[model samples]
Target: MRSYAGQPRPRPLPARYSRQELPKDHLVEAVLVTIFCCMLTGAMALIYSHETRAAIRRGDIDRAFSASRKAYFLILFSLLFGMFVSITWVICVLATLYAQRGP
Candidate 1:
């Protein structure tokens, strides 16, 4: 319909038109895995996770993906290294015990 001056009014916007969609940057997983496994690699993963979120906010999809991948790899590496250290420690302890057995 037209106004009193005979000018047609603009169409109304949809109720949900102003919503923004943000990316999920696996920050929690990074921190948790790092805290329980390897602090050094875990810190690296946390940094990358934060970078992923920032890249998403900046509308850089490629950068966000790269950062996410880095975080994932860091977490994986931390877990692997943690396992390696644990296994080595167990082996050393066993060897020490055997040596002390008077064999």
Candidate 2:
């Protein structure tokens, strides 16, 4: 349709940007790691993960980022601690077996 003289054309609306840089909520991973590793850390991680989603829903970008970082660190710490405990347990078992086999 042609605009008559003095009539202004309608401008197109700007595209809405998405929060693509936000971290993913790893609730399941946190729960699984907590079960296999340390329960407390895992629980904390799960909490943070849930908080991240909640913050996102609430449109609190800073809170979401903070929660996401907390969750990530908790998961990592839990995994590392779990691995350390397992290694120590294995070493103790090996030492016990060797001591028992003394000639």
Best by lDDT: 2
Off-target runs (Cα >4 Å) in candidate 2 are 1-17
Tell me which residue pairs clash in candidate 1.
none
TM-scores of all candidate predictions against the true structure: 0.71, 0.80
Best by TM-score: 2
lDDT of 2 by residue, 25-51 (tens): 888889988999999999999999999
Estimate every model's Cα lDDT from 0 to 1: 0.79, 0.85
Model 1 has an lDDT value of: 0.79
